[model samples]
Target: MRSATESQKDSAVLAELIRTLESWKETVVIAPDTPDADALASMFSLAKAFGDGDGRSAKVSLPENSLSQRLAFLHEWANLPVATAEDFARADGFVVVDTAKKSRCNLREDVPEDWDRGRTILNIDHHASNTRFGTVNWVVGEASSSAELVYRLLQAWGWPIDPLYASLLYAGIHTDTSGFSLPNTSKSAVAAAAELVERGADVVELGERLCRSQRLSEFKLLRTIYANTQLAADGRIAYSTADYQEIADAGCSAADVDDQVSVPRSLHGTRLAMLFTEGVRGKTRINFRGDSGVPALPLAKAFGGGGHDAAAGAIIAGPVPEVVAQVLPEAESYLNRLAQKP
Candidate 1:
């Protein structure tokens, strides 16, 4: 539980955020690259609420072919334009959801040249490692997810969250908490989810679509991830690796790897789990998951990455093997250090 002091601080920050949005005319909400349901859902609620005859004129940045197959419904549902160059050019502010740093969000070439410093930036996230890279930042790592935060924000702003927005919020919380199986799941998260279901969020359909829906190529990649699994330090460390060829052969794109890292992290005795994927033989992406006794962020930071205690990731410039050699020992040592902690 967060201390009273921390809760009060968060409340104050939220008040300021509401004040800022009250006067904003036009804005762009950006979800990071390879956005999961949480980021996209939060963006959906904020964007649609401000759209229509509403003078706010909030638009979202949708990257081409960046969304995974499961989340493609969002694009068509929103009926977003192919290019919002004119809207972006005229936007008075920018907002980013579920992203820790500027580098993490998709800053495509089509974005306005002054995107970074051109106007007000609102950074909202639930990661402990957030850099506060916004004109106003509300980085509450203890929050269940940014969707939860957005829910509260809409309520405070007196905006009506109908069934459509409720479903989006439910999707965000459901995915980020790993269906309430993850360590980050809290009592408040459960309460919020229950409330959303009461608000007509179709729990069964969202679960069926987000969890059970997987394309053929995604299934093939899962097979490769399982086959590549390796054990180290007497099973204290479980890791897997896949290069570009394996991914291509599986007919899966990089964005298709939604939760493949969860495969290694599911081992019974693993204190630390890692998944390494090489992107086009150029940069390798590493994902980390730590058991309760371990914290994943420190291990991620040791190699210049940042994320939550239970999950984190980094993209290092090296081939798969090279990156693996550098990360494995660090994972092993991190677990060892935690084991020795009194």
Candidate 2:
């Protein structure tokens, strides 16, 4: 639960986002570098909201074409095209969704420097670690996902909400909350979901697409993790790593390896799970998943990354072995502290 003061601050920030959106034209919406369902849905919704106006269009920017096929439904629902260099240059402003830090946008490498120079930047996210890096930051960590916040924003602005948009919002809330199984799944999340359903979000189809649908390569990656997971902290922590060769051997793409965090996390006794994957050259992406008593943020931040308590991630510049060697002890240490908390 947020304190009264923090709640008030969130309200003010949200109000500011509404005011800014009113004047925004030719805006660009950027999700995280490696966006999950939540980030993708949030980006698509914002683009839809802004792009529907007369003489207005919004560009959706991503690090690359890294989204899974499961999210292909979103591409069909809305023209969520990836922004190009020309689109970025033509954009007058930016709206960043589902990401906390300005640095995490990877915008520095993907776009021109002046993109951040004097343009209006709007930051909308639900992570507590957000730096309020935009001219107007509407971050509310109490929300289930950034999609829920976007839903609220549209309602506040009296923007149109169709079934296509509702499903996009529902997809974000569903995946980020792990189908409302995680502790971050709040009463508001439930209420918002109900509203989206009423607005025509197909709950059954969305659930199947988000959860049950998996590619062959994803299953192969899961099988590999099952065969190689290592335990520490007396079984409280379980971790696994997949190097480039192993990942390719499993016939998985970088996006396919992203969901492997769930494999170690599903262990019966594991309280914290980590998956270190070597995707990009010279960089290891570490994904964290924690149980009720184990929080992932501290460990993620210790490595210069940030996310929610139960699920977080970081990208370290090193080989897979060296990155895993450095991160495992930290996970064990954090679990030990949790064990001693009583």
On TM-score, the leading prediction is: 1
Candidate 2 error regions (>4 Å): 1-8, 106-110
Q: Over the stretch 158-261, how does candidate 2's per-residue lDDT look in tens digits?
A: 88899999999999998888888889899889999999999999889987887788777777777888888988878888888888877788777676655678
Error of 1 at 170 (Å): 0.6
RMSD of each: 1.6, 1.9
Measured against the true structure, the TM-scores of the candidates, in listed sequence, are: 0.95, 0.93
lDDT, candidates in the order shown: 0.83, 0.83
Where's the lowest-lDDT run of ten residues in candidate 1?
74-83
1-342 in candidate 1: lDDT tens per residue?
A: 879998888788888887877777877788887888888888878777656425667778877767888788766666655327777778777788999888888655677666655578889999999999898998989888899988987877778777778889989999899999898789888898988988888888888888888888888889999999999999989999889889889887777766788998898998889999974567888989888868899888888889899889888998899999988887777778888889
| TM accuracy, model 1 | 0.95
Number of colliding residue pairs in model 1:
0
